[model samples]
Target: MSWQAIAKKDLQDSIRSRTLWATIGIFLALILLLSWLFTDGSGEGTFIAAAGFTFLIGVLFFIPMAGLLLSVKSIVRERNTGTINLLLSLPHTRGEMIVGKFVGRSVVMVVTVLAGFLPALLYIFVQVDEAGFTQLLTFLFALSVFGVMWVGIGIGLSALVNSETQATITGVVMFAVLILWPLIFEQAGIELPSFAQRFWLFVIFADLFFLPGRIADGDFTFPSVVEFDEVLLEELNDVAISVGPHLQMWFVVVLVAFWIILPIGIGYYRFSTTDL
Candidate 1:
């Protein structure tokens, strides 16, 4: 079959599955419920921030789940069912098959994100009058990049692992890294003298790895209420030392390039060499 045909079939199969749609539904419901509970009737500062935070949390959960569920079986299921051999026996190249699967799964992820988030955008515009529309758009754009990176990581793991169980576990661990790292950093009190400098450097390197420049930049903001004065300057200095003005854009670009290129290259390499 042609590559287009393969891609189309994969897309069709994904759409027919309930997993993506159900996940999107859950995300939307959670966002709406949180907004209702936390947002004031007038929808002002705290409410808007709450809405933004809620959506951010939802995206974090949804992206990895979507990536893992959509991609974990792309190749392994075929092998389990003895279809991988038949597909390899065809005239199609391994590269085309791998690309087709990635494109298909990535499309599913993009569609699900839009489905879950677009209505939230509309609601914020109509109901919550506090946040600017541009802010929501900017946040969503950053989130889409985050989702895409997770999807790439999931596909890469799926390609490398031989068993479905192993692939599922790998995907879950990767998902945990994507979701839990920030929380861990927050709880560890990176502002402490011993941890401050190292933490800032680690944060920059993570931003370079994750391609989320806005998140890294936002991390530099001082808390609204500070209890300790002595460590504040030192902490801010460490953050400043971690990411310089000139390097921010370059770091984001390089990270994004690597995020896009490395996974597909590695996945294709693994798929090409593996015995089908």
Candidate 2:
């Protein structure tokens, strides 16, 4: 009830700060720059999937960073400046305020991503007509869901941290680890003996953060690498990790659902009970 009022006010503050416009500008520039590279008709043979996938990759990198930037200092700034007390003196309770901040910030992030993504979508429709409507829509949906998840994470981190610097450092480090962990894990046991290398293969299958990137690109099958002997033209069959129906797109939906709920849920619990 009172949450709606707080949420509206939050939206207004973000709008007045022009953060929304700045986010849109970042997306627009990314779309244009990547689109040019993707559609340049170079001899490298860039197809519809390639262009769209590349664009999705950009969305994966930029939108989450934007969400983190928007939210890392959200609550702490208010608290530090004594404005949070003023907000509390209004009609809303702590729970309402927590819910309002999350919802309002999430909406802003979603709208900002959509606005920036549309031009790229339109360009893809024109430059890569073969990409098709359904696939594009699917990619868009995945990107939107991914962005919302990060926004929720940022909001929760904002509520949980004591200072903007801590939230920002944590967010940046987490993002870096999430993006680079697979690369690190890949090289981890390379120098080990075959026995240890075989075990490391199992560790590679535990990649959770990279799955959303697969969803965004519409490539859902689990990664399986096969080594071949070029001179002999022979294939060596190795052990394959067995994955069930649990690895489907619905699995990604579940992951996104957990991300969206868990952070805000914990933040709400803490903020609701913490002294104002």
- List the candidate 1 regions with Cα displacement exceeding 4 Å: 1-3, 46-48, 181-246
**Root-mean-square deviation of Cα positions for candidate 1 versus the true structure, in angstroms:** 6.3
User: Which residue segments of model 2 deviate by more than 4 Å?
Assistant: 41-48, 190-245
Per-candidate TM-scores read: 0.73, 0.74
- Which candidate comes out best when scored by TM-score? 2
Task: Estimate the Cα RMSD of every predicted model relative to the unseen true structure.
Answer: 6.3, 6.6
Displacement of residue 208 (Cα, Å) in model 1 is: 12
Model 2: lDDT to the true structure: 0.65
Residue 66 error, candidate 1, Å = 1.8
lDDT by candidate, in order shown: 0.63, 0.65
Error of 2 at 31 (Å): 1.6
